[model samples]
Target: MVGLMSGILLAPSAATAQVSDGGTVRQLDQLSQCRAMTDDKERLACFDRASAAILASRAAGDLMVLDRKAVIARKQSRFGLAVPTSEMFGGGRADEVTDVRQLDSTIKTASAAKAYGRWNLELANGSVWQTVDALTFGPSKGDAITLKEAPLGGYRATIAGGRSILVKRIR
Candidate 1:
């Protein structure tokens, strides 16, 4: 009876130790791949691949999978491929509007002024903002904002209460 009780107590600990070793190996492999990558694009891709692999290898009840997923998600965002969620809008209601004016007709000067409190606008990368004081000419639906010179792509805008906007660049 004493031997059986000791075995039961030790079994879980051994399994846990095995899992820890596996996780460490996986993480080391991922780090090696990241170090081997040459460019920003390739590095991000590597992170994505490694993260997926690690997540798949995680045990059913392990919470570490969530951390791995988050790391990959952040890497994807650095590549400008992330899709913004509603929660990114800073806890405000989002609306779609139309008819933005271009500073120039070449489409390079186009600007979308998102009216989040007092006319606040956001750029496609969700990294920039434009604020207007008068609310006198704001962004409308189907309007595109120029994030950089020349057309990279279009962005979807989530305007919130004229205070904050979340823009996800559509690549």
Candidate 2:
């Protein structure tokens, strides 16, 4: 019973166990290191130092903390932009998380460009999409539109139950 008690006392706690798992964030890693310290005073000191470092990083714009919802919202907002793809913006395991495939919105405005009868359409979500293909029927203000990822390349915009036209985000 005495040996059992000794073994239990020496065993790593849950907090300390997590410290061994590698973390990608430096400020978070610093805080995790505090859990591994055995000495009470040393652990407390480490925590204080880590907290200060986190504050400094945040103020310097070197570190940011975002909830999953905020990250997903950001990804949706940037859907048709020319931004590079990454795990940071919904690029991950397909089974776990799928990328944004389409955006449904109302047309804020639509105008014909000077060249080739192509149309420039502004959506309610503040995304400006320009048609790559010449339009037979142009979209109008307040018309519901759906912008989807084209299987080949670029994007396709379906305007108010009309046919899909190849489009690209201009803004």
The TM-scores of all predictions, comma-separated, are 0.22, 0.62
Instruction: Please give the lDDT score for candidate 2.
Output: 0.70
Per-residue lDDT of model 2, residues 1-171, tens digit only: 112211001112333332333434455667888989999999999999988876666565555445455555666788888884435432335213535778899999999987777989988888888999998777789999988899998899888888888999999
For lDDT, the strongest prediction is 2
Worst 10 residues of 1 by lDDT: 95-104
Q: Which stretches of candidate 1 lie over 4 Å from their true place?
A: 1-57, 63-117, 120-132, 146-171
Badly placed stretches (over 4 Å) of model 2 are 1-23, 33-46, 67-77, 85-99
Please give the lDDT score at residue 147 for candidate 2: 88
